[model samples]
Target chain A: MRARVLVELKPGMLDPEGATVKRALKNLGFSEVEDVHVGKVVELELDSEDEEAARERVKEMCGRLLANPVIHSYEIEIG
Target chain B: MRARVLVELKPGMLDPEGATVKRALKNLGFSEVEDVHVGKVVELELDSEDEEAARERVKEMCGRLLANPVIHSYEIEIG
Candidate 1:
């Protein structure tokens, strides 16, 4: 199975990198860019054939290391 | 409008960061992790109310700065 994990900052949190990108975009003429937030996506290939097992395992991985739960939220999609 | 841009390395690309993460996971007992690839998600808020325009603009942003087309491919989702 294959898993796609998306980890994003919690609402109301500040994102320095995103701010930088927003500034750069504005300077580059994309003035309509009002806000930006940067996040991570991890794609994993697992040995399990069962989608449920793979999703559960990847969620565990996210909780353990892939995401910082204090400041971020994550979602998992398995195929 | 809002846009979510997912940028991922093209197939056959060497992802040292992913390899490092994979090794760390293995060391931490996630032995079922066959492979890992890390990517980026950039969420943007735009002034336009039109979803199509928002997606187009974000795609242009990806083409110019958010992603390296030669090594990465990006998908834009506007809502």
Candidate 2:
């Protein structure tokens, strides 16, 4: 199975890194870019016989370590 | 226009952050996860009347700031 996880800071969370990128974009002449948010993309290739089990395991992985639950939300796409 | 940019460390580039995540996954009992590579996903919502112009602008953004071209590669999905 393959999974792609996108983990992003929750709305209103302070994101200095993202802000920095936004500034850089403005400097680079992308003046129309109003906002920028940085997130993580984790692609996983797993050996699993059961799809449901894999989904559960990957969700647990995100909750436990891949993302900070308090400030981040994640979306998982399984294949 | 909307764009989703996926920037990843180039193959052979050392990724300590990704390695850390991989270790954490192993600790969480995802022993089947052999390797992990962490990447960035930047979603941009831009007001652009021209699709080609937006694509060019975003590509420049990634090249100049969003990613370190020497060690990172980016893919852009435009809508």
Candidate 3:
């Protein structure tokens, strides 16, 4: 199975790297950009064949290592 | 309008960060995970209303700042 995990900062958190990009864009003349948020995508290939089991495992992975629960949230997809 | 840019390292290029994560996962006992690839998502809120125009602009942004043409490939999405 193939799995993907999308990890993002919680809604109200500030993103310094993303803000730096926004500032750089404005300086580069992309004046229409108002805000920016950055996130991570982790793509994984699993030896397991069951999609459900892979998803559950990926979720556990997120909780354990892929994300910091105080500031990050993640979504898991399996195929 | 809202725009999203997904930036990933082109296939065959090495990803040390991702490889490190994979090793960490193995150490943590996720034995079923075969491979891992890490990518980035940049989400932007733009003042423009036209989705097509925003997408085009975001593509330009990707070329200029969000991605490295040599080893990085990007996808732009607008809403």
Candidate 4:
């Protein structure tokens, strides 16, 4: 099975990197860009064939190591 | 309009960060994980309401700064 975990900063959290990029874009004349936030995608290949089991395992992975619960949240997509 | 840019390393190119994370996961006992790849998601909010123009602009952003064409490829999603 293949799974993807999308992780992003929790709402209300500051994203300095995103802000920097947004400023850069404006300076580069992409003034239409209003806001930007950077996140992460973790693509995983699992030995398990069951989608349910894969989703469960990936969720655990996200909670345990893939994300920082206090500031980050993640969504899992399985295939 | 909102746009998402997913940037990933090209196949056959090494990902040291992903390797390190994989090793960490193995050490943490996620042995069922067979492979892992790390990528980036850049979420952008643009003032433009036209989806076609948003996609074109985001593609240009990807080519210019969001991704490195030599080592990475990107997908743009617009809403």
Prediction-by-prediction clash tally: 0, 0, 0, 0
lDDT of 2: 0.87
lDDT of each residue in A1-79, candidate 3, tens digit only: 8888888899889899889999999999999999988999898989997878888899889989999999998878788
Model 1 Cα lDDT, one tens digit per residue, A41-67: 999988888888778788889888999
In the order shown, the candidates' DockQ scores are 0.87, 0.74, 0.85, 0.88
Taken over the whole model, the C-alpha lDDT of each candidate is 0.90, 0.87, 0.90, 0.91
Candidate 1 lDDT for residue B61: 93
Residue A31 local lDDT, model 3: 99
| Best prediction by TM-score | 4
lDDT per residue, candidate 4, B1-79, as tens digits? 8999999999999998789778888889999988999999999999998999889999989888889999998989899
Q: Per-residue error at B3 for model 4, in Å?
A: 0.6
The alpha-carbon deviation from the true structure for residue A8 of candidate 4, after best TM-score superposition, in angstroms, is 0.7
True contacts kept of 1: 0.96
| Highest-lDDT candidate | 4
Candidate achieving higher DockQ, 1 or 4: 4
Candidate 1 local lDDT, B25-61, one digit each (tens): 8988999999999999998989898787777888889
Which sections of candidate 4 miss by over 4 Å? none
What fnat does each of the candidate structures reach? Answer: 0.96, 0.72, 0.96, 0.90
User: What is model 2's interface RMSD?
Assistant: 1.3
